[model samples]
Every structure is written in C-alpha cells, then in structure tokens.
Target chain A: MSERYLFRGNHAIAEGAMRAGCRFFAGYPITPQNEIPEYFSARMPDYGGVFLQTESEIAAINMLFGASAAGVRAMTTSSSPGISLMQEGISYSCGADLPMVIANVVRGGPGLGNIAPAQSDYFQATRGGGHGDYRTPVLAPNSVQEMFEFPKLAFELAERYRTPVIILADGLLGQMIEPLEYTFDPVDPKTLPKKDYILDGCKGRERRVIRSYDLRPGYLEKLNFERIKKYQKIEAEEVRYETDHLDDAEFVIIAYGTCSRVAKAAVRLARNNGVKMGLLRPITLWPFPKKMIEELTGKTRLFIVVEMSMGQMIEDVELVVKGKAPVRLIPHPGGGIPTAREIWERFQQFREEL
Target chain B: MRKVYHRPEGLTDTLMRYCPGCGHGIIHRIIAELLVELNIRERTVGIAPVGCSVFADEYFNCDMIQPAHGRGPAVATGLKRANPDLIVFSYQGDGDLAAIGTAEIVHAAARNENFTVIFVNNAIYGMTGGQLAPTTLPNMVSTTTPRGRNTKLAGNPIRVCELLNSLDGPVYINRTSVHTPQWVLKTKKAIKRGFEIQMAKKGFALIEVLSMCPTNWRMSPIESSRWIEEVMSKYYELKLFRDLTKEEK
Candidate 1:
C-alpha cells in the first residue's frame, strides 16, 4: 500500500539514483537512454544536484569517474556507439574500483549500428572492455519496474565491489512505463562513508591518490590476480537469474534484458497452445549464471536463446551446456523487439528439428 | 622548500609503465609538479585517459580516478560540476582526445567546462604500439601508415588548439612541446597557467603538449625529442590559442 509510484523505466533510473544519493549526472543524448539524462538535467538542480549534457558518451563516462571518485553516486546513459566511446572510461573505473552506474540502452552495432531496439552490445559490456583484465558488474533488467529498482542495487553493487555496475536495458525497456515502489530510506549524501581516495580541493589535508598502475611486473601480476579473485567472488555471489515454470517443461527458453520480456510473452503464448515452454532469465551478465545454466542442461535438451545481438550470450549458454543441450539465438539488433509470433515460430522450428 | 623534482608526494610512488621515451611521463611529471606547487595536491582529482596515459592517475599524487578511455573529459566534467570547489583535470592522449573522443573534447571545451586538459600529442600511437594518430603529420610513418601519413588518404591531423580556438568555449588553449629542456619548462608553465585559470573559474583550459614516442618512432629518446622539435613543430606550431588571463570582453 505504501510503495507505489507511476514512472517510466528511465525516470525510475533517475529516481533510484537520486534515492541512492547520486548527486551528479553527465550524459550525451541518445535513443532510449536520453530520457534518463533529460530527467536528471531538468530536475536534478531543483533537488541540489548538478546535471550536464556532456560533449560525448566519452565525456559523460569520464565525468562519472570524476564525480564518483569525489565519493558521490554518478551515472551516464547511451546506446551502441555511445557505449563504445565509453569503454575506455569504463575500464578506468574498473581499474580504479570507482563506484558509478552506466546504462546501455543497447541498439545494433559495429558502425552506427541502427538505433531501433537491438541488443548487440552484450559482448562489449560483459567482456573486458577497453584494455587489460577488468570487468564491471552488468545487470540486465527485464521490466520498467526492475529498471527503476536496479539503480539503487547498482550503486550498492558498485560500492560493495568497489567497481562499476552497468544497467543493460534496450530501447523497449527504457521506453516502457510501469508501476514501481521506492523501498530505501531517504539518503543523506553528507552521512555517506568518506572516500579516502576522493580529490576534494587542495585547501587542506594530506595528499591522497588513486590509480591502477603497479610498475613492478611481479606486483602488477599479483594485483591482476587479486582483481580476478574479486571477480570470481562476485561471480559466485552476484549471479542472479529467475526461473518460471521451470518444473514442467521440456523446452527452457533462455533470454535476458529486453528479449527476455519477449520470451516471457512467448512462454504464455506457447503455454496457451499446450506447447509448454518455461523461461530462464539472467539478471547478471558477467558473473553469468553458469551454474544455473549447467543445472538446467539436465532438465531440458532444447533451449532457445533470444537476444538483440547475433549470438554472444548464447555463446555463454553453450559454454555452460558443454554440448549437453541445443542452444540457438533469435537475434534482432538495432533495438528490434521481436513479436510473440516470431518467438513461437522459432520454437516450432526448434521442436521440428528435435 | 626543496624542488623535490623526482615526484610529488600526492603522486603515486610508481615507476613509468610507459615504453621508453614515451612523452606521457614528461607530461605527467609536469602536471604533478604543478599540482604539488599549487598545493591543490590534496583537493585535486584527476581522470586518467586510455592509451598510454591510462596509468596517469597512478603517477599523480592527487586523488585519481581512472575513467573509461576517452571518457576522461566526461568524468572530469561531472566531478567539476558536482563540486565546483574541487579541482578536476583530465590527462588524455592524442588517440584518446582527437580520435574516438573528439566530440567529448570539443563539447567539453564548447560547454566551457571549468577544468583543465593536459593533452599529450604524439604523432604515433604509443601504448598499443605505433599506429596512426589524429595528430600524425603528413609523410609520417607509423604502424597503420605503411608509406607515411597521406592527408588525402587518411585525412589531415587536426590541430586541436586551432580547432578549439575556432569555438567559443575554452578560456585558455596552449599548444606546447616537451622535446627539449626549454620546451619542457614551457610546457610546465603552460600546465601551471591552465590550472591557475581553472582555480580562478575563468573557463575550460587546455594545454596540448606535443609529445614523442621513441619506440614507436623507431628512434632514440633524444632523437624522438629532436624530431618533435624539428618535424612535429613544423606541423603543430607552438602557440597560445586562448588566454583566459586576458579578460575577454
């Protein structure tokens, strides 16, 4: 009764960030993710926050690094190419363990990959972008409600892991409106833990420093190993996925982000027709739910992977399946949201093959 | 007080990860000294770049935040906007500044962001090993430029300060070099001035330091420095494109 609000996914992200103590925002306008910066820019200052339209996605991400290093919550949003521009900054944030949120309303890519609803950035976001061995925690939100709720989770994840967290949505999820709830206590930026690494102003205090460079070859190697250890722990602890109708199904449809919504709709369509297909939706991409996928391999021989990309996450599903099951990709890039009929047809083709 | 030229106390006690003769070290040291002298060492925040300067935060004694490559300007913009009292700067390289990040640099400067940019321009890429850069001069040979940089084929290297000067944003823009002791001193002065202007809230300040890549250039460090003076300067002439101290009407 107490936790309801009417909001769009993008607005929810802005609200969540504000609730989570994010006081700065810098972003270049892009499809799907534009509303996020638009909301913050228009309303942030009214709430004692600062909003800026950065020169580029590259600028927005670097701005996030600046604000986050100052020990405040900050974020930026963009689609495909914009996200590519942000890879370098994302790597730096990962290297430095800076806490910030990056939202990628992915569209198709390679060049200015179309801006329709596509999920082509899976490889870029989950893989170690930029250079070096570093990974940020990537979350795939399936609904407008999840969209609003995930920013706070992202901030917490970023602070807990001392790294960046990405909210990987697509055009559909970003554009859609939904009912959501605000669950957290009112945030006071003044009471947040003091960041020993923040660069305040040089008026007082001893010099403070932050960096990912370890010149000693051995030490660099050790530091990299330690970072990997942290990633491993995160993979183990942060892997989140949802299983619906998993108990009574011969075919389990695997998807994430927006495609999973299509998959959810397809599950209902297939069930009404007596085909009976369950769904497995992964929320976390980097610490991918490999264990869950591995376990699901025994329950189903045919698994359908729908994505906006050509076949990146499907590759992850295959890796865990280890040839134990059949995995296929229903790719729609450039923000193309597939219809329930298309998914149903794909399921028919898979069933025919079986 | 002692000069303490080795490094700054706020700077990380890390050695150079840059390849031999990389100009990033020179630029980093100059900025480090400026930060130290300005006594903003404690309150300063730096956004490190991609390419060779990704480790910039490591060498600086101030609070460093390594941003996604090319995203330094954006991050620094956020930091500066969030806390107008904080001193924020972005140390970016040619590849990071003029290539994929061109829009970012232009827009940040265009917006008259209250920060400084230490842009290190080496005609060839350094960190990922020699490749053609945005600042690569005509007839320059690099990994991607097998038969020298052809302006007709690969496009002319952008003169950042000149290009930015054409805009209405930046309050200070100086293009210098670190190829010689005199130039290094000049570069340091330019850096200090940029920081000084930022402290005074003049506007966006940029110090484009003509740098060198010895290993990538297939030349000795000394020769590379000389090349910067003899060849690169001919293409990217040293000039102060904007002077914030002059009080624009």
Candidate 2:
C-alpha cells in the first residue's frame, strides 16, 4: 500500500531517499538543496547511516563516490552551480556505470544567475554534460508526491541500468511545502537485486578492480557500443510521460515539471472556452517521449512548447513534430514561473491561429 | 592462509610497462603479490590516474576505472559509495594528487573517506617530461626549474605524508622510500598495511612512497633512488601518521 504524509518537496525527497535505502548522503548545501542534507544529517545517525556536509560540491561527489563503491546506496544534492561543479564526477560515474543518484534543484543560471527557480539547465541535464560520450537517466519531478516516489524509482533504475540517475527539480519544487504521501514507510534493500560490482574489501574474494579505461581503439569502441545498447534499452523501457485531456484537442502543449503544472491550468481554461487544448508532460527528459508524441501527430495539429528557459526543449519538440504541426515556443526567463493567466492568453491566441 | 609469493588472481600475466628502475613497477608488483596472498584480486577496483602511469589500468590487470587528472580519488570514492561491497583503491602520482588535484585528495582525506590511497611521490613530473612538480625539492633543477627551484618565489616543496598525516580521517599515513633493497621491503610493507586498513573497511589509508623518476630526474635509476633518499626523504619524514587499530573509534 502507498503511504501518505505531509511534507515539502525537499522533505519528500529526503523521505524518499530514506525509504529507498540510501544510507549515505554527501552534499554541499546550496539554496533549495540545503534541506536534503540538513534533514539527512539529523536523521541518518539514528539509522546507522552517514551524512556529510562536504567542503565543496566536488568533495561531496567524490565522497558519494566512495560510499557508492562500498555497494551502499548513496546520493548528493545541489543547485545548478553546485551541480555544474559536480558534472565532471557525474560523467565519470556514467563512464564507470556506477549506480548512484544526483539531485539538481535548479535555480536561475548562465553563471550563478540567482537563487530563484528556473529550468535553464534543460540542455545541460538532458544532454550529457562534461567531456564525455555518455548520458545519465534524467528524471523531472512535477509535484510533491513525485518528489517522494522518484528517489526510490531513481535508485532502482540506476542500479538496474548500472548508471547514474539525475533527479531534476527546480528551486520552487525543492522548497515549497506540500502534503507528501511518504516518509511513513521504510524501504528494504534485501528485496532489491544483489549488487556484486562493489569493492567491500579483498577478503574471501578475488581482487575486484573497477575501472573505465578502454584505451585500445577497438576495445573503447566496444565499450561505447555496449553503453549505447544500455541507453537504447533505457529509452525503450523507462520513458515515462503523462498526457491530460487531448483526446480530441486541436492544440497540445509540451512541457515538463513546473511548466506542465501551469500548462494544465491553461488547458482547463482553454477547454472551458471551447479552445480544445491539452498537456503533454515529459517526465523522463533523456529517453524523451519522442515516439509517444510522434504517434499523436495525427491529433496534435498545433504544438505549443512552454518552458522557463529560452525554449531549449522546444528543439526536441520540433524534432519529433517533424514540421507535421506548427510548433510554438512560450518562454519566460528570470525568477518567475509562467503564470496560468499568461499561458491561457497564449493558448487562446494559438487556438484562433489553428 | 595462502602462499606468500603467488601472482594475484586479478592481476594478469602482462608485466607492468614502467621504465627500468621505476618505483611504480615495484609498487605494482607488491600490490599484485599481496592481492594474490590475500586472494581478493577479483574484488579489487583500482581508480587509475593520469601520468606516466595513466594507463596503469592496463598494467594492473584488474577492473580499473580511468579518471581525469587528480580526480582518481573522486572516482574511487564514487565507486566505493555505489558498491560498498567492493575493495576500492586509487593509485596516483604526485602531480596528479598534490598539484592538479590538490583540493580533491586533501578534502577526501579530511572527510575521512573510507578507502585506500596509494600515493607515489616521485618529486618530478615523469610522464610529461622532466618538469618541476609541487613536491620538487628546493634547489632542485628540472626542465622548468633549470636554474634550480627558487625557494623565495617557487615556494617550499610539498611533503605529502606530512600533509596527509595532518588530516583527521585517514586511518594510516606513512612515508616510505624505494631507494635501496631494505627500503623497498619497507615500502612494500607500508603498501600492504594500507590495503589491510582498507580491508578492515576502516577510514582512509595512504602510503606515500618517495620514489625515483630516473628518466625525469635526468639521472640513472640508482642515482634517482639516491636523490630520493638524500633529498626527498629530508623534506618528507618517514613515519605513521594515523594507525587505525590505535586511533580508530
């Protein structure tokens, strides 16, 4: 049975991590993400776990790396700038196929832009960051309940795929309080599949060397191919999306996270006005519901992409739309989220155009 | 109970590719030989660093992960966290650990990260040619410090063992040299102690071996070892910084 409780998105995440058997947390506190480690630091010791507020994001990631090497569930949370500091470690985790979770509570950015909410890291998170040919599972949580459940799923997915999985949320989602339906139950690690690729110690076992060096051109290529194969599997099986009220709509809006929440408001208003509009939120930004959206080309005549950035994800929308429908971009920058009133105005204007 | 001299199970038949008189060759052998004795080669995950030993991954004949320069500790830490069941170690050079990755290695030790660190202090950059490193001794002349290192401007040489010893988390920190037959034996023992601490799942352990970089030092392997003993050991003292059994909580 699903458990329920009252908590903020950040607390929900902390509760979810605890539920998912994450016993180690190494994070440098930043705006919107400070609560996670703060919560864990106060609670981990009671569970015989560890919570370290590292000197910097770099140290936190490496510390998380060490804990993960021990075959324990470990994680780290940071805002955009801190996440930027951690990208190198994240890429290494990917190259090594290390199972762990990295939460990015995105705030405004380009360069330490602000301490306010923003989805400007869309390109960086969804696409691979750092110097590498690798991709991590990117999960976008839209609500407080998702914040509670995603970590359990994220950890499971990471271990299942033997790769890093990112929980992409914004400052707003991270800080705002809501009634979360978790933090009431504990997750058992024994029920999970056994992970054998850890370095506990060379006692009673052969020396286990975990490395990611494919120097031989042929060998490196083979490793790359294998990674791609795994990515393909993830794309096929892990792509999650939610569609609302578009069965016979003429116009559909593509968004994720907070943007989707606003688009829903617009969808409701436009539907009442006989404007036939709906919402398509992409939860897994990496696998991208391109095929799912593609299948809707017959029904989705006009595509409207709403985002907090300068239309980064719209590119993906256009790629899938394939010019089949006229794709429109509605972007708002700075510290503000797109309000329902503004979205409704835009949706109605686009409604008349179609 | 096991034989003291058999090749470790994880180590392959390929001999290390380090140059003659290279301390890394001896260190690698010692680690592999110890793994064989302990019989845990299959569970050993090595985080390889960039340097003359950048490809140490290939030579180690184990599951190795190549991390960026000075980031081996970070990578090794990640592996250990994700797989607490594995025995993880990072083998790094002075240039990789002390200079480029100064922050990473230092903070890792400071945090008392649970793992083992094999720090080979050769005092000079060997892989990239005869360049002066952070650990280069005073008055030492290399390609960069041709006229000798200016203590006034170039600053004092780094003593890794001393620096690491000052940290709070590590279980053991020892400085050993590979200058002579006797010292080589001692260095091997230090490396084993480090691995043993890691086996205990104790906090961080490190062995900073003052090694000779013959090709980079612009001297014969024998002279390089002599310089290590005469000059390097002077700045870096040989002793245990923290012992797990005595100091662990």
Candidate 3:
C-alpha cells in the first residue's frame, strides 16, 4: 500500500504535477488559487523545475505555449477572471496543436463575482473559450484524491492528443483538506517518449515551424477538417463518468465536480428514506457521458440536473435525452452550493408533483 | 570563377514576400548572414511576430514559432528558460512590440531575460493598412491620422530605447537607421552585438532599427530613405542608449 497524507486540493495539484514530470510552470496569483503558485514557488525549485510568477495571465499562458513547443510538460493555474485573460493564448495553443495543462479553480463570475466556489464556467470550458474551431478536453475533479491523481492523467491525455487539457475545479475543492494516496509511481521525464514535433533546433535535419495560420485559399479549411476528425475520435473514446446505484435507479441526478459530492449524499439519503435515486458524475465534461445518459433515459423517470450555475451542463443532458425523459434543473447559481438536505427536500417535492 | 557574393545558408530558397524597398528584407538578410557567421544556425530558435513579417518562419532556416501578436518576448522567455542552450530571438514590429505587447516586453526586460530582441520601428502599422503607430512622428499623417497627427489628442511618439534605458535590467540598448548603406551596416553591427550579449548569457538586449514603409509613407523608395534621414531620425535619435559591455571592460 502507498503512503497516505493529508493535503489541500491546491497543494495536491502542485505535487501531482511535479510527479508527472511537469518541468515548467508559469502562473499569476489570483484568489482561491493562490496556494497553487505559492506551493509551486516553495517546492518546484527542489524538483529541478522552472517556476515563473508571470506579469499577467496572458503572459503565463503564452509562456506555456513557448515551453510546450520546446518539448517540456508545462502548466498554469488561475481563477475565472484570470482564465478569461488567457483565452487568446489558449486559442493560439489549440491552433498550433501544442500540448499543455491549465487548471481553473472556479469562482463566481460574469465579472469578479466573489472568491467562493462556483461552476459558472462550464460553457466556457466545454466549448472552446477562445476564438477558434477547436475544443479542449476538460476534467472535473470532486475530491482531493482526484485532484492529486488528475494531473498525471491530464498530462498524458494532452500529449496523446497534442491539445490543451483543463482541470476544472472550484474554490471549495481547492481549499478543502482531505487524506489521499499516490495512485501511480513517479514518472521520470527522461523515460517518456521523445516528441518529434518539438522546436529544439534544426541540427542535422530539416527546419521545423510551429504556426497557426494558413492564408492559402483552401489550406485552413483542410486543417479544420483534420482537427474535427481528431476531436471526433476523442469524443468516441474518452468519455468518463461515475455512476452510483444506476442499476435500479428511478430518479437520476446528473452533476459534476463539487456539486456531485452533494449529489452523491442526496442519493444515499433518498435510498435510506426508501426512494430510488441515483447519481451520474461526469469526469470528462467535453466528451460528456452522452451515450450513457441516452441509455438511461429509457429506464429513468426523471433526470434531475444539479449545478452551481444557472444551468449549463443541463443543456448537454437535455440534448442527449431529447425529451425521452422529463428533465429538471436544480440550480444554485453564483457562489451558492446545495446541501444534501436541500437536494433531498427538492427531490421529494418534485416526486410529489410527478 | 570565385564566388564574390552568395546567399547565406541561413536563409531558405523561398522567395520573400516583402513589398518593394521595405526594410524587412534588408534586416532579414542581415540576421541570416549573422546566423551563418556565428555558426549558431543549428541551435537558434527564432520567434516571428504578427505583422508584415508573419511569414518569416518560412524564410529563416531554423526552428521557428509564430505566436500571438506582441507575445514574442514572453514566448522567447519560455523557450530560453526551458532550454538555455538554444539561442532565442524575438523579431517584432512597431505595433507588435510597442502597442499590443508592451506588458510582455517590459516584464521580460525587467526580469533581464537572456534573449535578443530585433525591434523594427517604421513609425506606422504596415500589415493592417497604414494606421498611426506608437512611434509615429508629430504631424505625420497616416490612414487614421487624416489630419496631421495632433500631439494634443493622440500624444507624442514613444522613444523605445530611451524608455528602456531608464530600466537597469537591459545590458545593451541601441537605435540605428537603415536609410543608407553606412547606416545599414551600423544597424547590422548593433544586431550582432545584441545576439553576442545573449550568447554570453549577459542579459536582455534590444536593437531598435528605424525602417522605411514607402507604401504607407506615400513616398517613393528614394524619398522614403531621405525622409527617414531628415524627419524620423530627428525625433528618434540614432545612438547607443546603454552598453554594459563597456562598463565591464
């Protein structure tokens, strides 16, 4: 058995990235996520990694673009407003097909809403946040253990796809403390496969150019089509989610990240109270559990979607359900998190109406 | 027959797309020649900015990356810090360096990043039609400045070398023009010095080259050179603003 330690979500993310062979990190300080940069500043040098407190989120993301193009695993973390500043660079990374990881410890938003936990960036994260014909795979982690384990998986997926990956967490998940165990052995970067498209130099070979624009008549169109096929393959192969009591579930609760923790509790509370409620927590938000939801639609009576937003992921669930089952939203928008009692009470009322 | 002059091996066979009499071709040739002379072509990484030289990745025979507009310095910082052995350079224009990317360049210099910056100041935006640039001279008319540039409303032009000279981080800061053959040689020397300082791991260095934009200036190639000599040079002085090498010696 591996050793277990009590760690905060933010510090676990930093340690996880270090063990995953992340050699470069550049980020600016922001609310709720400041611990990530602080942890990296204290520990990254000991790991023989580069740590840069960039001037702004824009510079941090662009720095990741450069470092990743030079063939190293790089990452950055920010909150919502800062992540907004990084959209341009993120779009450029997608266009250039460079691999890197970004973590957004979400907070209330529209504009500087608050530093409390919220999931208002679902549309922004699932849909490409920047101006481009592209999509970034998003991982939603609910626990400190998932936070500790997700970076390695995120880096692997990023390199495997040659695309940016986002770890979408909230302020609550980042600040909470929990005990976790290291699931995988530490990875040595030297043992990793060599990247052929890196821009180290043109020593004894043809020169390489990493660029995003093709101004030719039909070149950009062809590039977009190729990228679409890659995204399609990802959609088919990479959908991840966790289901609890789905075998005999009459009422299904669909959620992700911090909201799903409350949802899982509500499911157990309903089961003890002699109700048949189930939970489906989507781990990958972009390659959503569409097929499973569609399959569940035939047997379920009602799909209750719980979120900390006005209702972002519900649109995806509803799209897949396609009116086959009745879909309802339990929203706790803008810094408010639902409790197990509150969710169970809401479910009781909905079931009475049904 | 002995080869009196030939193309530098650092440049590819691709034909350049710069306009007639534009100074980008001249500057590109100078950089290419120096890359061959320094024998760092095999280990050099060049950053192309978002301007008329956006296609520079195709022209330079080295590993290149074209990042967002004005983000060349930040990208170079990443590349150089990640792999210190790679000689990195950021090639940018007036709009790219002074207008959109001011924060990145300022912070890179403040950190004393060991990289070279090739700043081509032509006093007007070239790629996006002829708009007034941060370096546009007083009373110089551009597409945006239908009337002569009013210092009251638009503010005076920025002298980049003077501004950066105020900061102690930069090791070498020079401003040279390419209007005449003699001045072109001087500009080449300044660029070589910038790269040499970076190779020695000294600190940040920038060579600001005063270039001609004849199509935007509404002048003939000969007239543009004369205007740079007479008008543009008076406001943005042609001189070395700082040099730490001399201090060390």
- DockQ leader: 3
Model 2, A60-176: lDDT tens digits are 776666566667788889999999998877877787788889999989888878988889888988888776788888999999889889998899898999888999999889888
Q: Over the stretch A181-284, how does candidate 1's per-residue lDDT look in tens digits?
A: 77777587888778666667545565555566667669988888898999989998999999878888888989987778878889999999997689999999
- lDDT computed for candidate 3: 0.94
Task: Give lDDT tens digits, candidate 3, residues B1-249.
Answer: 899987788899999988898999999999999999998999999999999999999999999999999999999989999889999999999999998999999899888999999999999999989999999999999999989799998888988889888887999999998999999999999999999999999989999999999999999999999999999999999999999988999
- Judge the docking of candidate 2 as incorrect, acceptable, medium or high: acceptable
Assign candidate 1 its CAPRI class: acceptable
**Deviation in Å, model 1, residue A130 alpha carbon:** 4.5
Q: Which has the greatest TM-score?
A: 3
Q: What C-alpha lDDT values do all the predictions have?
A: 0.82, 0.81, 0.94
Flag regions of model 1 displaced more than 4 Å.
A3-5, A109-113, A129-131, A201-208, A212-215, A265-277, A308-312, A325-353, B1-37, B46-60, B65-72, B90-102, B118-160, B174-192, B207-241
Worst 10 residues of 2 chain A by lDDT: A201-210
lDDT at position B98, candidate 1 = 93
Candidate 1 local distance difference test against the native:
0.82
TM-score of chain B of 3: 0.98
